[model samples]
Target chain A: MASPHANPSPRASRSNRATTVHLRLRKEIVSGHYPQGSALAEPVLAEHFHTSRAPVREALIALEREGLVSFEKTGRTRVRTIEAKDIREIMEARAALESMAAGLANRNWTAADTALIARNIDAQANVQSLAELSRLDIDLHHHVMLRSGNTRLLQLWEPLRWQYEAYLVEIFKRQAKEDYRPETDTIPSHRKLLKALSSGTPAEATQVMMEHVLFNMTWAN
Target chain B: MASPHANPSPRASRSNRATTVHLRLRKEIVSGHYPQGSALAEPVLAEHFHTSRAPVREALIALEREGLVSFEKTGRTRVRTIEAKDIREIMEARAALESMAAGLANRNWTAADTALIARNIDAQANVQSLAELSRLDIDLHHHVMLRSGNTRLLQLWEPLRWQYEAYLVEIFKRQAKEDYRPETDTIPSHRKLLKALSSGTPAEATQVMMEHVLFNMTWAN
Candidate 1:
């Protein structure tokens, strides 16, 4: 995580700019500022970022890979609409990857790692809105995957983060419309997963993590 | 599976050209014509393919994604040198995904699927060279993944194919130098895996597939 202010080589600077643009655009999409099915015009985004079209175009390609956006038949980019089947597929993929992450993390667990997860759970307990909680949930999974120390595993898990966030936003919105809270106690599940990673062997941690992730599929049902 | 002779739409024809160039270039690299660390110059490839640079560049990018070629510091693409560590990592990844694929495949397995896997096993038994056997080995796993009925799982398995082939070439070369024919019977493992997929439940199939894939790691020792 290079500091935003770091003045590196020209090539590094260009990459850093791309990363910054990608994150900002991803945030806009995840925050629901970019509505589903809305066009993300390259020129408009380049102007907004105060950068050339190159980085914006690269960022959009990354977003498409992350399942946040798609190129329409008309050769325009738009925010992807989340479908019920996409949600189910996302949960299934997340469970497989995160369970593997949990096992890998357990092999190299440290006190600091456990503490980070604990802090995430505590932060989740304090969130007043589903959106905040959902963001924290994404962070918790990211933390565990990062802790796994397998670069390829982390790369495989990266694209799923925003897909999960987008799904969360859609689910919360539907819940709000219905005036009903999700029945699952997501906080407890996170805490249980953290505890399993801390106190149990890799196999046990993997089992618990898989169950925690599978809970999302039940929510979809 | 479209025939090369098929007169399709212009766009489809362009895509088919790209695929043809990609496969031809991949074969040249895998057959050791493009030695490890040799530059894959875009213009040279375009000339070789008798096409414009666009499709050749696209093919190079696809090869890069497959872990066969990588961009060097000189801003030129070259063949990637597969390391022993890469072999280990590739095997680890293959095990994880193939194990999941086996489970999904079992959930949707038909007698036709079982027969197809059995045929793969029989084909493996008939291979006269280590290279041929290695290819059939890849095909066997590919068949299982394609049968998994999970598109995401199949996408995850796609890029690993050529990496496995490259690793096989390296391993076979090393073994040839040592005058060592690997004592382990890889064919029996495939046979057992197919038998498990044919008769066992998903969990049982998953365990067998994991064991089969993990056998490669033990070979490294």
Candidate 2:
């Protein structure tokens, strides 16, 4: 007889299997397809992903480390519940990390960096909905981290991005019926930061960046 | 014939099985027992832990999330190499986050808080050896983060303690033979910080904390 948790036959190229499984499960979790506190069994996930339990198990663990899931020492596996406090904590961390990134980007930015930021700003300006605007906002922050030239900073902040994106999606979906503006005025501050970077005053840039981050945090609240 | 990656027999308890495997493997990777870039096989790890591939697989995935290992599509996992750049980025982030935590701790600290900090400082004063001193130093920082009342900050900085510990141990081992009294002298700064916290001047404490972090960052150089 086959084992209760027998491995599924492999169905995909192994090279991208992990990434594929990770993305699929991540999307399911973030999109609210999987209700909070749902059980995520390894054998079940493997069957869903058409892969062995090995990769699916790894994906869930990755999600746990990313603060997207929690685990307990039960005989079976389960998905952890997301709490408001967790969301708040993630927001606070994002504010601090992003503020630092923005400040560093301001201080170290070149003309080319300014040009890239300008393009992002323009793209964001053209976006109509809060969802589009939020995605652009993420891209803008990513641009800053990339320009800041801090690889570790980027890595430290990367895991939080998915959660942030989920939160943004949730908030935007709730406010979809309301009139939402594109936040075009925030571009002026970004421009000022660019000026500070060009002048080589990281301190001033950092202050501006702090204000920018605080502003976003308040908006989230 | 038994499959190469298949478990030959079943286990009695699977709950502690995963945690036990995870802790053992994490210890090996964290202690540098596994050489960097060394491949970690699921079957091999399962056999060594006297468990099935399921729990061992889960542990490896968790390790990957912690940056202790990297999984590739080639159906193999390896210990991640710690790069100088990675260290530097982590330090930069630590500097910013810890500085913020210190500032908040200072602002919110009551007389009781001051007493706790002072106690830790006094404990550090009695410690011998650079390693013990380093451990106390981290404990002090952890205490500060806890006192800051920012749960998010604590969670964000949690995983980083491992990297910090590893770096500290390496640096302390190297500087043990040399006269590094100046580093020890920095202890007084912690005292000064406590005084600032008692005085309710968070700005001053934040400045001092930033300097303290920057000072530690210089150690790796």
Candidate 3:
């Protein structure tokens, strides 16, 4: 081994700032505060977020990797304006992932796992805020995927979840301002999905998840 | 936007160092030069590589994310000793992703694409060095996945590809030392895979890929 010549870098503290900046930037971009296709220069973002250029730079890279930001040809970075084709592609990947998750989750689900989902439904029913309602919807799907115990599957789905959420949140905001009720169909549809997972075999649960992801509910994309 | 208060970080040049460091360290770890579970102190690695701690740190983080390195409970970083369970899980994920890729590659492969695999087969037939042979094997799968035209699928497979390659390369090195010839099954098997993709339906190609990934060959775990 070589003699040590350098001090250890501050990975933990720096990583925390990068993560905080990443999540906050993701929210800002998803909420249309940054606006799609607008320039996201590192120094500008650093100034806006009250952070150093390093954390902002790290956040931009993470966002770009997640497909929420684009590195443009002329050396500029911008919020990605996701197209319908990209949306369709992401949805396809998400469908395969969630379908796989459902089969694995249903294989040996514990009582607590079932109760967790049932409790999520109860929360959905009592929720008044559309934002919270939409969050609960995302939370339930996340719960099922988490219950799958397939870490790789969850890891693969994670970036897509963030990218997809970026689009979904926009829709939620629009629907909220119109004072529209949360879609009545969501609760029943999720209830059906829960029933399929609980009583049906893995294959049946897989099929239901595929259908639920592909057709049961439509997103604006 | 507020006036830029800081010059943009030297992202391009610095990222190149990070990448250079990352690939070199991955090779060292995969080659067992830095044996499994050995402490990978940043200062030591930086000194050995003749670079500052920043690039070494960046490389370490990337390797950790790829599952080739582990961040220990006691705050030391080490090369991960991948367990059988982790191997099984990764193989399962690879099987599904490659199966999907095979189907998609078959759906719309071009003449160039067909020629590419054919050329790769020729190269595979002529290989003498196991390391070179192993590289070719990885290359062929990457080509097929690239032809799938599903960016997200490839993005998801990319990390697993690196990790799986790490294990496969160790086996290759061992076989080379023992004077064991490259498996006679591999060339023919790939020929079959290529043929199926060329002449069969996407579903058939997909089925062949699944079986090919799950069985057909064994590796030392």
| Candidate 1 stretches greater than 4 Å from native | A1-9, A13-25, A38-61, A71-78, A174-184, B1-9, B13-31, B50-62, B72-76, B177-184
User: lDDT (CA) for every model shown?
Assistant: 0.75, 0.71, 0.75
Answer with 2 or 3, whichever has the higher DockQ: 2
TM-score for model 1? Answer: 0.83
Chain B TM-score, structure 1: 0.86
TM-score of every prediction relative to native: 0.83, 0.83, 0.79
TM-score of chain B of each: 0.86, 0.79, 0.84
Identify the candidate with maximal DockQ.
2
Candidate 1 lDDT over residue span B86-188, tens digit each: 7766666677677877887888888998887777777766667777767777887888888877666666567667777876777676677443242247766
The fraction of reference A/B contacts recovered in model 1 reads 0.01
Give me the TM-scores for chain A across all models, comma-separated. Answer: 0.85, 0.81, 0.84
lDDT of 3 by residue, B32-111 (tens): 78666788998999888876776687677667767788876455788887655667667766766787789888988877
Model 3 regions lying over 4 Å from their true place: A1-14, A47-51, A72-76, A122-133, A171-192, A216-220, B1-14, B47-50, B72-76, B118-134, B171-192, B216-221
What ranking emerges by TM-score with the best candidate at the front? 2, 1, 3
Off by over 4 Å in 2: A1-15, A35-44, A72-87, A183-185, A198-200, B1-15, B32-44, B71-78, B81-85, B172-175, B182-184
Model 1 chain A scores worst on lDDT over the 10 consecutive residues at A175-184
